[model samples]
Every structure is written in structure tokens, then in C-alpha cells.
Target: MDNTGFSLASLLVVTALGLLVPLIVTRIRAVRIPIVVGEIIAGVVVGKSGFSIIQNSEWLQFLQFFGLAFLMFVSGLEIDFATLKPTKVRKGNRYARFLTMPPVFATFATGLTFVLSYSLSQVLFNLHFIKSPLLFSLILTTFDWLWFF
Candidate 1:
């Protein structure tokens, strides 16, 4: 099939699954999951990894790129500006813990996690997704505390 035709079909199927699967899952309450994660599950079910309904092509990459941009835009919109400002707090308190934990502890933790994951990926098995230990480390280090509250 042509790129345009395949892209459109893929987009339609993905959009439908992305919208429907999350709604169904939330309604069923079969283990609460994030919508984005649900969408990813839907994608995997239809994509090359699952049913092989769609192939990973350059056309699909364009869609993925645009979808990522859209997701980032939505995340930016969700950010609370007030949270960006520093607040006065006592030393060695809960707030102090939150403030210090990510930068100080996460740095060492992320490095260690990267090395371990990389070694495991190399020695234990060659997994396609765990190809980039640095990227995995960055994901681990970038702690979004806002998600808790």
C-alpha cells in the first residue's frame, strides 16, 4: 500500500483504539492505568510487536513525532506555575526531603541504574527497547513530584 493510504488507515485505527481502550479500561477498573500508557498498550497490540497489523515505517515515524509533540504540549499545559517558585521551609523536613532527593540521590541512583540495566541488557538478554541506557537513566532521574499530589 501507498504511504498516504497506510498512514491514514493507521492513524484512524490508532486514534480509535487510543480513545476506546482507555475508556473501557477505566470503566472496568481492571487495574488503574494512565491514559497514555493505555494508548501505548493499544499501539503495541496493533503494531509490529503484537498482531503485526502495521509496520514501523517512516510515515509512521512522522505520526509518532507529531503525537509526541502534542503530548509534550499537553504536559506543558498541565504544569502549575506556582509550583515553579521556591518556598521557605525548615531544614531536614518533608519539603526538604522532596527538594533534595531528586537532584542529589537521583544522580547517583540513575547512574547505577544505567550501568546495571546496560549490563543486564547486554549479558542477560538483548532487548530492543533497552538499547539506550542513558535514555533510561534520564527517565529515572527526571522525577515529577507533582504526579503524587
Candidate 2:
């Protein structure tokens, strides 16, 4: 009821949104959208930006931190460290072998993602779709990495 205190109802609403948005998005055969993106849209619609239905509080902040930690832990568990180990090249030249390494490939892919994201962000900024190119690029880069994991 109070502005500064915790609300169990708000927490329940957030949990329901988190569960339902992904289900709804997946069930829609015509519209393609990532589950995470759908959850974010729901959050923006219900939070202060749209209807001011969920007010910020210390409990919600703590839950957010915990959720992020759990996500990172799950991602870490999904990693196959065996695939990351470099294998010996029997015949190729040094440059060819180096490029074949998993770590090198991953690094190259990540760099390419950042470069493309920055270019697209610059275009969006010029069109007034975004305010800051660099910040948007960084956010895009982070999103790409998160989605990859």
C-alpha cells in the first residue's frame, strides 16, 4: 500500500508476466520474437514507462540481482570447455592453424558482431531512432553475447 514498502502482489504480477510473455510469444506462429524480448516489452508496458503498475523497491532490486546471477550460472553450466581446447594441426601453416582454433573463431565472431552492431547503431542514431550510438552499440553487443550463451 505504501510507496516505499514491498508489495507481494507486484512481485506475483512480475512473475506471471515473466512466465506468460514467453509462452504467448512462442505460441504465436505468425509473429516471431525472442522470449527475452517479449518479457522486456511486457516489463516496459507494466512498469513506470507505460502504466506505472510496478513501483521500484529494495525487494524487487534484490530479486533482479538474484535472477541475473542464476542466469549467469545456467549459462556457465551450458559451456562446453572441451570444445574450447585447441587441437593440434597436422599439416596447415601457422596462420591457418591459428584461425582454426575455437577460441580464435569465437574471438573473431565476437569482434565482427561488435563492428556490425556499431555500424547499425550509427545508422539508427542518424535517423533519430536512438540518442547515443556508442551506448546503443554496447547494449547491442551485450545482448548478442547474452543471446549466444
Candidate 3:
């Protein structure tokens, strides 16, 4: 589009509306979900798929990167390191098992994914169906979260 598409007014209005949707949805029905979900949906609506408010601005890219970094920093800040102390604090046996379970499950999933991808790659390569194993590896890694869950 043109410079008129990325004007300050458009950005501010889109951002406000994005924030407002989740607020209004949660307030009206008394249900709760993350604000980030609303923000992502609003982004899709205002993106090329919908109204096309902003079109690939460099400033917006930079701001998105900075926002992600800031969120990670804030998450790290909230972690309670003191709770993990062995002498000063006591933890139930279940806490240790719970912590180990997620990692174990993740490890198993990663290994299974690798094995499946490798077997598929071998069969496809033998049949001349696919050009490269690297391409198959990339496809496996690019799985959508919605599909996995």
C-alpha cells in the first residue's frame, strides 16, 4: 500500500481495538484467557488477511522483537529461585516428580519425531519422492502447535 496506510492514527486505533476486544470479551461473559491470544487474533485481522492496517513496517518489526525480549526478561524476573533451596525450604516429593515428567515427555516426543522423520525420509528418498533429507527435517521442525495439541 501507500504511506497513508501506516499513519500514526491507524496504528493507534488498531492497537486500541486489539486491546479492547479481549477486555470486552472477558468482561461480558466472565471468562478468562490470555490477552496475548487476543493480540495475535487482532494482528491477523489487521494484517494482509483482513483490513491491512499496517504493511510490513521496519519500526513495527523492531518493536515486536523488543516486546518479545521484554516479555522473556519479565518472565525470568518472576521466577522464585529461593523456593528451590534445599536447606532453607522443603519440597514435597511430588514436586520433584512433576518437574521431571515434563522433561521426560518432551524428550520422548523429540526422539519419536526424529525417528519417524528419518524413516519417512529413507522411504521417500528410495522412491525418489523427495529431493533432500534436510528439507524433510525442516518440515518436521515446522509443525504447528495447533496440530500437535
Candidate 4:
């Protein structure tokens, strides 16, 4: 791919279309999913898994990397660390228990899911390009503060 593929127009138009199509899908009354999931679906559809239509240039990948890092930082900031403190009155308080549930839940769920469907021919499975199912599960279960306020 030519370096010229990283132009601002290409980046903005493609990203906008990817996001916009999902937004449009969410407009249907029966479709209750969030825009973020829609964007993910759109990405998979256009990505190497579906059509191999969009080849991400290094610049685009870098931008996505930066955005993900910033989003994760923001999500971490939103966490109320005070709620996580151990309390004597309660063996495990509500907030603390709630915080613990996701990691435990994700661990079991991702492990089971991965164990059940871990095989795919290198030709059909695009996620194998990442080479680590553990990393994929972590990425999948990462908090989507993007979904909440």
C-alpha cells in the first residue's frame, strides 16, 4: 500500500461511513444495540474477515492505538477507587463485589467460549492474526465506557 493512502480525506470519510452506517442501523425501532457494537460489526464486515475491502495503513492503526489508550485511561479515571477499599463492617461490600464480578465473569465466559470454538483454518479466521486468544478475550471484555454515559 502507498503511503499516500493515509490522507486526511480517506481517513475521515471511511471512519465516518463506518460509524454512520451503524448509527443508521440503530435507528430501526427493533434494533436495540448501541452504536459501538454496530461499528464493530461494520468493521468485521469490511475487514479482512468479511471482504478484505479496507486495508488499514500504519497511520490509521496508530490513530486507533492512540484512541484506544486514551479511552482506556478515561475509563480507568472514571472508576471510584474509594469504593474498592476493604470495609470491616461488611465482609465484602456491594461496590467491591460489583467490581470483582466482571473479571471473574469474563474469565469463565471467555475461557469457556475460547475452549469451545478455538479452531479455525488459518484461511478463514482473521482474529488468529493477533495470535493470542487471551488477548482477544481481554480486548472483547474490556469495559465499553463508550456504551455508557
Candidate 5:
């Protein structure tokens, strides 16, 4: 194929690698790592940072977008919204029930996370490990929700 055109062989290779990563991860029982982590490492090895084996193409970009959307959709499906309903708190005022709601609790937890992250980031900044504590804290805080799904 021409230099500008996409190759089907490259797509096949990517697909095969994607399928093989999980199997490889499972086969090595001693080394415990998430499949997603393994896949990311494999991608880095094959991508421009390592070998430049996987050429960027329109079809690959489209597939990447679709895959991300599908992953988010599947992750969102795991949430149990029904449990988010407010529950009664005995011997408390009207606002107590509202405080018991999952969103309120989540907000409180997020705030706590930001506070902790900011403190840690401040230490890192003092040590010259990072430039901006606020930005680093924000990044760390943002990743807190990723574990939920």
C-alpha cells in the first residue's frame, strides 16, 4: 500500500494484540496486573512512542472513539440508581433524609478527596515533584470517580 493509505493488515494486528493481551495477562499468574493496564503497555510498545508499528488512520480513530463510548456506556450500566433514593434518618429533622441521599454523600466524599489530594499535592510541590498543586490536585480528584465504574 501507499504511504498515505491505511492497511487492513495493521488493523488485524491491532485486533490480534488486543485479544492476546488479556490471555497473556491471565497466563502469568504470578504477575498480577489489570488487563487494561497490560493492553495500554502493549499499545505503548507498538505505538509511536516505541516502534511506530501502528500507523494512525481515519478508521482506527473512528474505532477508538467507538470503543471509548462503548466502554463508558457499559460502565454507566453498572450503576444502581435505585439505591440512590433518600432514606429516613430516625430522630432527625426533614433535611436529614436529604443528607442521606447518595449524591450528597458522593459530593461530600469528592470534597474530602479534593482536600486530601490538595494536601498531598502541596507536599509534592514543595519537594519540586510537581509545579502546580491546584492542578495536580484537580487531576487526582478527577480520577477518583474512575474507580466507581
Candidate 6:
């Protein structure tokens, strides 16, 4: 692949088109696809796979981290303890619901991730290794406090 064609204008055009195409497709189909999916596809298009316009750019990595941090900060700002007043159902039920969902979801996700990791490891490495499953399970079990809002 020739790297000489890469330039600022080419990069902007590819990035813009990457963002635009998914929205256009979603609009035409009248389907609601998440912005994150669109953004990831945009990254893949501009990265190594599609146009290779901005392959392995450090700037993109920084921007990704910035986005994540900004999201987390905004999420943290939205949640307030005063907002969680439960109706007269039962004692501590409101607190339980708020606290329980995250761990439950995290646990379910971890289990699913571990199963997938184990299966992939066994298939690809041709070895009956169990370390990856436990590691992946723990990794997936973590919950972002910012996402709790």
C-alpha cells in the first residue's frame, strides 16, 4: 500500500464520510443505531481496514481516552443520591435495586465473557488452558461507577 497519498485533507474527508455514511444508512433504513457503533465503524474505516487514512495514529488513541473520560465525568455529574426516593414498596428496596443491577449485570457479562474466552482460547491455541477465562471473567466483572447513573 502506498503511504504517499495520505494527507490532512484526505484524512478529514475520510473521517467525515465515515461518520456520514452510517447516519445516512440508518436514516434511510429508519432504524435507530447507537452513535458508539457508528463511531467505532468510523474508526475502523479510517484505521487499518478500510481506507488506511489514519492507521495507528497516536492522536486517535488520545481522543478515544478523552471521549471516555468526558463521558464518565458527565455520567458522574448526572447521578444524585437525593433523586432515588422510592415509593412505599418495601424497606431498602430502592437501595437494593440501585446497587444490585450493576453487579448482576456485571456478573452475567463476566460469565458470558469467560465462556467466550475459554471457547476461543481452546479453539485457537489448541490447548486446554483455563487462565484466560478467569482473567477475562474478572476483567468483565468490573463496573464503572460513572455508568451507574
Each candidate: RMSD to true structure? Answer: 5.8, 3.7, 7.1, 7.6, 4.0, 7.3
Q: lDDT per residue, candidate 6, 85-121, as tens digits? A: 4333345766666545555555666677667755665
The TM-scores of all predictions, comma-separated, are 0.57, 0.73, 0.47, 0.46, 0.72, 0.44
In order, candidate lDDTs are: 0.68, 0.84, 0.67, 0.62, 0.83, 0.59
What would the per-residue lDDT of candidate 2 be over residues 64-112, giving only the tens digit for each residue? 7887898789889989999999988889588989988999988988788
Rank ordering of all candidates by TM-score, starting from the highest = 2, 5, 1, 3, 4, 6
Q: TM-score winner between 1 and 5, please give it.
A: 5
Q: Write the per-residue lDDT of candidate 1 for residues 1-149, one digit (tens) a residue.
A: 44444556666777678679878877855466667767887888898789977755566878789999999999999977765555555676775656554454556666776677556555433556566655564565554444334
Clash count for each candidate, listed in order shown: 0, 0, 0, 0, 0, 0
Cα distance off (Å), candidate 2, residue 130: 3.6
Worst 10 residues of 6 by lDDT: 140-149
Q: Model 1 off-target regions past 4 Å?
A: 1-12, 55-63, 91-149
Mind giving the per-residue lDDT tens digits that candidate 3 earns over 4-24? Answer: 334565557656876688776
What is the model-wide C-alpha lDDT for candidate 3? 0.67
Instruction: Give the clashing residue pairs of candidate 5, or none.
Output: none
Ten-residue region with minimum lDDT total, candidate 4 = 116-125
Model 5 stretches with alpha carbons more than 4 Å out: 1-3, 25-38, 92-99, 144-149
- Comparison by TM-score, 2 against 3, better one: 2
Q: If both were scored by TM-score, which would come out higher, candidate 1 or candidate 4?
A: 1
Question: Residue 106 CA error for candidate 4 (Å)?
Answer: 10
lDDT of 1: 0.68
What is the TM-score (0 to 1) of candidate 1? 0.57
lDDT of 5 by residue, 73-120 (tens): 988998998888876678767677766888998898889999999999
Q: Kindly provide the TM-score of model 4 when superposed on the true structure, using C-alpha atoms.
A: 0.46
